[model samples]
Target: MKIYEITFSPTGGTKKVADSLSNELGRDITGVDLSDNNEDLHEFSLKNEDIAIIAVPSYSGRVPATAAERISRIQGNGAKAIIVCVYGNRAYEDTLVELQDIVQKNGFLVVAAVAAIAEHSIAHKYAKDRPDKDDNRLLKEFAAKINEKLKKKDFSTPEIPGNRPYRKAGNAGIVPKPTKACTQCGLCASRCPVGAIDKNNPAKVNRKACISCMRCVSVCPHQARKINGLLLAIVNMMLKKACSIRKECELYI
Candidate 1:
């Protein structure tokens, strides 16, 4: 049986958790990057003997549209799947349920689910240094349980959390603007998941198109991109209380 590590991690935190769990799950693993805009997601297919670990970062407590859309294109062919939603300390309200639905609709049979905490992509203060030692241990345990289930031929779907009609996604208007330090390297444009940045003019961004995933900000080699100070401060204040107390990883099997 093959193990597929399918993920959409814009800022690396989600991928970190996914990779750790996958390492514990199996030795032979194949990666399917849902964040790559140029790839044809429909080309990927799986058989009943395959296992797919579909992981994505929770954006405002919901699955990112790009991830969701890409995930729906893959042909699961009744392969067993483990759904994982990584959040930034805050609750991942409907992300798990929504992701389960998407993958199941595409013919995956979800056998397990996980909700994990990672550092906030925007506000780095919350859940800092996460997917750390403790998280990895817990994930390893989860992987063992999943392997047991598979051995038992338990393909029953786990009860995933979240509402059917997901909460309305809040406006993600924190577009990163290139600072004077920007050299118009076009790296930001090339790496943008949504094609929000202009390739010719790195400074130019389509605000309407930007999902505010901060891929450009995180990938900037020169540290040239930045969000507005006042806006970032306001966001930090709003998330302070929710992110103050540390949250732990959760598993459903």
Candidate 2:
């Protein structure tokens, strides 16, 4: 069966987890990077014979709205999917279920699900370097389980953790601001999925259009972009109870 790895990972954690799982499956994998600068939402397609591994990072216990919109545009072509939601040490509340619904709407049947942990994109001090060695080993075991299921053609649905109504959607449109180190290189603006910044003036961001994905802040080579310090502090304090290092990866099939 053809295996496709479709992922939206600006900070690389989600991608790393997806890659580990895909590699352990011992199948040739096709990467569909949702973060590609020139990605056209309309261009992706799948077939009934294909198996898709859809991965995305959890942003505030939900899928990034921009990535979800882009993913919704693809035709799943009746492919079976393995949905993965990777988050920082914080909870992944509704992300996996939300992603499952989105993928199914695009005509894919989700046969498996995973909620994995990765380094926090913004609060790097929290999870540190994650989907680390321990996580990788768990991912390998998860893959072996998936491979066995596929071999037996077992397609049973597994229980994915999340409340039905889901926690209310969190703040969506907070844009990152450039700090004193910004060189006006326009990288953030150009790479922004929603075109939220003025190309000529990278410092100025249209907050209404930003999805608070922290892509710009994480991708800045000079580390010039930053979220509001007060906001980060508040968020961290509120999330501290859910932020204890839960570092194992698993598969539900």
Candidate 3:
């Protein structure tokens, strides 16, 4: 049986959590990076014997539109899927339920679900340096349980946590853009999951299409991409309450 590790991680925090769970599952894992817009999102198909471990970060307590759209195109073909939502200390809210629904609608059987905490992509002070050593050990324990579930003949769909009607996103706050430090390097443009950045002129960003996932900012080698300082300060203050508390991981099977 093949193990497919499918993920949409912009700033690497989600991927970090995904990797730990995948590593404990088995060796020779097939990685499907959902963040790459260059890849043909619709081509892959999995057999019934295969297991798909899908991991994605929560964007404003909802599934990122780009990631959800790309994931919807994949043909699961009745393969078992383990849905994982990695969030900062802030709540994951509807992310896991939305992901479970998406994967199931795409033809995968939902067998397990996990909500794990990682360092905040935009806010470093929240859940700082997470999916830490302790989280790793706990993830391994979660993986072992998932492995056991795979052995069962009658698969039961686990109840995942989240809202049916997802919360509507607030006003478009601030989107990150390259600063004077930008070298016009095309890395940010090419690496943008939503193709919001222009490849020829990396400074140009189509804000309408941008999800503010921070992929460009995280991958920028020059430390150029950033949101407006004043707006960021406002966000920092707002999220302080939700982010100050440490959160833990939970698994359902």
Candidate 4:
């Protein structure tokens, strides 16, 4: 059976967790990058005999709007799916449930769900260097169970956690702006998942359209994009307690 690794990782943390799981699941994995706005998401189609690891990072305890929209466009064709939501040590809250609903609606048969931890995209100190050795070990174990289930032809939908009426997604008001080091190479604009940045003038960002995924900042070769120091400091303080304790990976099947 074909294995599709679908992911929307703005700053690589989510992708790191996904890679660990996917590597343990099997080989010859076909990847579908939900973060690429340039790709035609409608073109990705899966067969009934395939398995998909649909993963995304939790944005403010909710599915990223752009990722959810792109995932909804894929033709699942009843493929068995394992939903994965990666987050900082804080909490994933509604992300897994929301992602599960989206993939199911797109024709995927949900088999398993996982909530994994990764380094915080914005707050670097929280969950720093995560999806670390311990995280990978747990993810590998999760993959083994999923593989066994697939071999048994078991497609039972796991009981996913979250409220029916999901909490309203919080705004990540922090937007990265260009610094003196910005070379205007257009990389950030082209790589932005939401098309919030202007290609001609990379410095220009549509704040309203921006989901604050931090892709531009992560991809900037010159390390020129930066969030306002004061604003970031405020966020760090607010998330301090919630993100202080180390979180572990959780699997449902």
Candidate 3 residues 149-217, lDDT tens each?
A: 787654789888888888885434457978999999799998988898889998788888888788898
**lDDT tens digits, residues 1-253, model 4?**
8899999998998888889988998889999898988878777899999999999999888999888889989989999999999999898999999998899999999999999998889999999999889988999999999999989999999899997789898989788999999999999999999899999998888999998888899999999999999999998999999999888999999
Across 1-253, the per-residue lDDT of candidate 2 in tens digits comes to 6898999998789999999889987568888888775877577788887888999998878888877987898899888899999988877889999998899999998889988888887777777889889888888888888888877887766787777787788874456899999999988887886788789999878878877778888878999999889888877776677776465676778
**By summed lDDT, which 10 consecutive residues of candidate 2 come out lowest?**
243-252
* Each prediction's TM-score versus the true structure: 0.98, 0.93, 0.96, 0.98
lDDT by residue for model 1 over 57-133, one digit each (tens)?
Answer: 99888999888888988999999999999999989999999999899899999999999998899998999989889
Clashing pairs in 4: none
User: After superposing candidate 4, which stretches have Cα over 4 Å from the reference?
Assistant: none
How displaced is residue 154 in candidate 1, in Å? Answer: 0.8
- Candidates 1 and 3 compared: the better one by TM-score is 1
TM-score of 4: 0.98
> Candidate 2, which segments miss by more than 4 Å at Cα?
172-174, 245-247
Model 3, residue 92: C-alpha shift (Å): 1.0
Q: Rate the local accuracy (lDDT) of all candidates.
A: 0.91, 0.84, 0.87, 0.92
Clashes (backbone N, CA, C under 3 Å), per candidate, total: 0, 0, 0, 0
